[model samples]
Target: GGIITQTPKFLIGQEGQKLTLKCQQNFNHDTMYWYRQDSGKGLRLIYYSITENDLQKGDLSEGYDASREKKSSFSLTVTSAQKNEMAVFLCASSIRWGRGAETLYFGSGTRLTVL
Candidate 1:
């Protein structure tokens, strides 16, 4: 079995500050992703990388940036946190998809709040 770990279970930042989050997975999967979940917005993708050094922008990448520095590690940075913003950042990995969306395993999650 494999596991995913995320650092800093809670993150608090000032408005307009750049905040970074890190994730590591032992699944050895080929694809890793970062998504943001708001109170009612469901899950919105921020970025994904199919392999090491590869980067793909998702539906909600406007204010975020991500990196796949290695096969088992992925990180995300909020360029500028908004005032009173709050969301859960989820990190996930998959075994790669041949056609449709593949099943992804996620970390516990990192909660972020901007004051």
Candidate 2:
């Protein structure tokens, strides 16, 4: 079995400030993703990396940047924290699957609060 780890279970940032989150996995999976979940809302994909050093922008990629520096780690940076915003950022990994049902295992999530 494999595992994924994300640092700093909570994040606090000032409005308009830049914040970063880190994730690591031991699964050796081919795909890793970063997503944002607003209060009571479904997860929205922000960015995904298909391979080391490969980045794919998702529907929610605006105002964010990500990096896949190694096969086991991926990092995401929030370019700006919005006013009165709160969200949980999640990191996930999946094995390579062309089309069918590919399940994603997620991190506990980093809760962010803008003040």
Candidate 3:
């Protein structure tokens, strides 16, 4: 397990458009997570996959989709981009030992802009 990276530092999309974000890692951990960070609120979990080929919705899963096709990557999709919607999507990964996660590392993030 080494580093986690998110692609496209900035993402711009039109209203009602479908947007996708991607995350990649270098054989570091077991679980991956996507979180949405608003202007003021804390980072809200959007989705997570505990194992390869598994996906789970998180607190802010509405209007979004996620997939973990392999251990090295994960992706998220916005079903519909709402005008004026802007936020930072963060990608994180951790090693699951027992019931908790460790060695958690976060990517720089992908900022979304809906116009």
lDDT per prediction?
0.94, 0.90, 0.91
| Model 1 ranges with Cα > 4 A deviation | 99-101
lDDT of 2: 0.90
**Runs off by more than 4 Å, candidate 3:** 97-100
9-108, model 2: which lDDT tens digit per residue? 8988998999999999998898999999987888999999988878999999999999898999999998998988888899999986577536798888
lDDT of 1: 0.94
The best-first sequence of candidates by lDDT reads 1, 3, 2
Q: Per-residue alpha-carbon lDDT of model 1 for 6-63, expressed as tens digits?
A: 9889999999999999999998899999999998778999999998989999999999
Candidate 2, residue 3: lDDT: 83
Model 3 agreement with the true structure over 38-97: per-residue lDDT tens digits: 998999999999989889889899999998979989999999999999999999988864
State TM-scores per candidate: 0.95, 0.93, 0.93
